[model samples]
Target: MYGPVCFLAPAGVDDPQRPSGGNRYDLELMRELGELGYPVKLTPVTGAWPRPSGADGRELSRLLEALPEGSTALWDGLIACGVPDIVQAASRRLRQVVIVHLPLADETGLDPQVARELDQAERHALHAANATVATSRWTAAQLTEHHGLPGVRVHVAPPGVCLAPSAPGTPSGGRHLLSVASLTPRKGHATLFAALGALPRELPWQLKIAGAQPDAAYAAHLHSLIAEAGLTDRVSILGPLAGAELDAAYAWADLLVHSPEKEPWGMVVQEALACGLPVYASDVGGVPEALGHAYFPGETAFERPGRLLPAGDSAAWAEALNEWMCELRLRDRLRTLAEQRQRTLPTWRSTALEVAMALGGFPSTPWHTELEAAPLATS
Candidate 1:
């Protein structure tokens, strides 16, 4: 709101325009913030390692070096997660705000070294910045638990889901089941595939998992699971279908399932709700935090949702799904709930308003009092 807003993120894909999950969130924020009449500029920087770059780290080094004095930058992506060293060298004096889309620690899961470095990097950036925002309360909690983030420093502000498609169809007897997520371990493709395999053969169902499979090992793992499950024909793993293709997939899907082990905030879950499609998801992360159990149930059937099962249990997932598949009355009710939940969340326009408010916002209550009085649990 003061100096120009610079959005810095990793450009993993060659195409400057193509952005993955974290980068996509940055783009959304940039667009919304611009609409709020704030000065915002998006820069897709090629950070060192992981992301492929022709200019390599030199491109990012030059840009960070060239940032004018006394400017404000809403640093996006995993600049803190991937390149911890840059946060100290580049962000000096600049009004830097660390936005946590996900906790870096949970991402590593097994790789403790990377996790430790990222955790420290993010903590350093958080300490250096004037302020911080966690897209979901789950992420906020994760940060506090793993990274010693000061309670007064972090606030929760969720991304908005526009009311695009007012009402979605439920997964009826002849309806389709869809899942959208990048091919990654945390996404829980293996669980979804295993559940599908466990389902009865004559269930008269087809599954389509949309999104790119960049990780070859993960892709192979999914393939092996699918083949073992005998879902070669019933399941189609189409990579990254956007535009008309994405549209058709949404329209065709009667029920959408998001089985990620942990997600800060699931864009796919929100997208499915917008399409008026009933959802079944794992109760592992911020996804349920964003879309409550009023629409998504736990253990048993939900009026608005068929059911929500625990994470990592393939048999339980399959049982819940199978039960929902047969109940036509439950399907219609679930659709109503999906549509209702979609309506409650803010649109991109209002999301900008929230961010803008945070940028220049003053304390109505004492920061310590406000945070300590109540633990944050909002999306």
Candidate 2:
């Protein structure tokens, strides 16, 4: 009797109509679920995720007023999460579910008040949901371990990726290494630059870092650092890589690297892997869980994050990059290994089934059982 459900997220950026990172992910799945015979609705936040708009209160009010008595509306990002004093009174009467993508606690540089607001709201969302899902066990553990929720109660649904099929050899042979991450401080682009500074010679490869320039001040810092490191000619800051732009970056890259300090679940890692490219991700959050040998084949899987100086050490990040760039045989071997791993990787069809299960009434069919029992028996 759960009627057609809705997936709510910060739909767009400041414009409210432009699609952002997680918004695209949520909408894509919503459409696929709808096509799979479930009536699915997408609700946008007044503005964007992490940046709640006054429109948020209005949107929640609209959802409450519009939904029929017993239907559910599932929220898709961190913004919709914190059911605080504001949201507690605002959304209390509604039937809701929350898919915890990443909590805001890791935004260590944000205002304390903002962090507290998120804390209060997310806890309440977790408490009130008909069900809440965590994209990784790491996140579920954080909630359960800190918030006192039963870990088993929160659903764990691994993410899925859709990569454009590419002819690997021709596309990946160009002279560039690609790293995709936001402009946030935690993403560690500066470290990669510093690491590159230490190389004896600038290899023929150039490094392209893509994502929106988050804050102007941070962008200024990166610009200064790159100039100081003498990398203006070798490193390019390509703003907001999406769709064909991102595909072309992938199509022209020699390899991929991600060095984020606050990566909860890296979507780009999966995208790169699915594109038949290799990845060298920092050792943090769910990156290793997604790319380690357990889930990926031997060659394609990185040797987990090694002692690259420290987590945010730019000099150390450079060392890793330099070493990785020099190892052609290793990269080739891993690329082959990844192809084998793709054989077991989950597709959107399987991801949708898992999502359906988390929403309660989804059945325990063969698809469900297979997913329930699967995972790399990693130590």
Candidate 3:
């Protein structure tokens, strides 16, 4: 029998006040892996990850030292990527797998030197890992190209989405737009506001943003932009909402507007798709992959669930929003495609199985074969 898999992640992964794609992925993946009977043990670490304090580093080292020798453990890149020395030391005994959700240097608004330093640290940390798992094909490719890692060493295990009830879109044909991303520079809330500001007052659209304000300054800037654009009345900034509240936000919206400057794999994209909410997002990172091709069965002609505009381009975003708001036929077409894609979306079970296989080095185990043979269910 395969031994237990030790999964380590940030302790705040389940914090409703700090909801994020990475946190959601960690929570769902751990739960699903356990449900799949993988004998998984979760070790939630507390710290300012990717830049933990010295005390946090010592705690992590102690945890690693306590684990049985040769035990397999998967560490979230947020925790592992910034501390090469600690991880390298742990590598002597435990089998290490690091899951890179996003390259550390890809975060927006970092100083050039800080970005470079982070990039260097990440390269060292990844090299110390026995194998690396990237959450998207784009990320895996980026790691191989940017970090000089052998392509074979980095594996792809895209985040999966649970199918949600189809959103009952508004009668206004796509007037209620929703932006679900944290109030941070990387999420491009400021750029989204700029795009919305450029739209004509007669467009008859209202936006509701639902995300955590982890950065006080960025949140203030978003509010400032909203006021500057005279969108104060048209935009509602609701702080982080979880579970049914988040679901209601999706149900209440006609479209999901994602404006991230850098995203590795947008869990929100697939979540939006699962709810049958078409996404109009920046064409960066693995967003295009998450917005997978939508089409009728056996049909060669396919349509994207929504539009992909240039990242951080307010003009391009304005153009797409105008088109979505004014064109009823276009709105109908996109909605249909979104629903089609939703039906075929991958589930968390499959994602867990993929992670299991990756951790097991694609071993031909009995459970692996059984799970693979079982058809994935879509609600």
**CA RMSD of each candidate after superposition:** 4.8, 5.8, 5.7
Stretches of model 3 off by over 4 angstroms after superposition: 296-299, 363-379
Best by lDDT: 3
**Per-residue lDDT value at 182 in model 3:** 87
User: Which stretch of 10 consecutive residues in model 2 shows the poorest summed lDDT?
Assistant: 370-379
What TM-score does prediction 1 earn? 0.86
Residue 228 in model 2: shift from native, Å?
1.2
lDDT (tens digit, per residue) of candidate 3 on 179-293: 8898888898878888889988898988999999987887898888899999998999999999999999999999999999999988899999999989999999999999998
Which tens-of-lDDT digit does each residue in 1-379 have in candidate 1?
A: 3557777765553343232456556777788888767789777665463333446556666776777876666766366444545555565645566677876667735477766766676776665565567777777677656666655556566777655654334325335888888888888888888998888888888889887776788799888889998999989998877666877888888888888887888877777777777778887677776565444434344444335668778988888788778877777667767766666665766555555655653321222333543332111
Higher-ranked by lDDT: 1 or 3: 3
lDDT of each: 0.68, 0.64, 0.84
Tens digits of per-residue lDDT for model 2, 166-202:
4254333535778887777878887677777778764
Q: Which residue pairs collide, candidate 2?
A: 82-121, 82-122, 83-121, 191-314, 195-318, 299-334, 300-334
Error of 1 at 12 (Å): 4.8
The better-scoring model by TM-score among 1 and 2 is 1
- Backbone clash tally for model 2? 7
**What is the TM-score of each predicted model, taking all chains together?**
0.86, 0.83, 0.93
Count of backbone collisions within predicted model 1: 3
Better of 2 and 3 by TM-score: 3
Residue pairs clashing, model 3: none
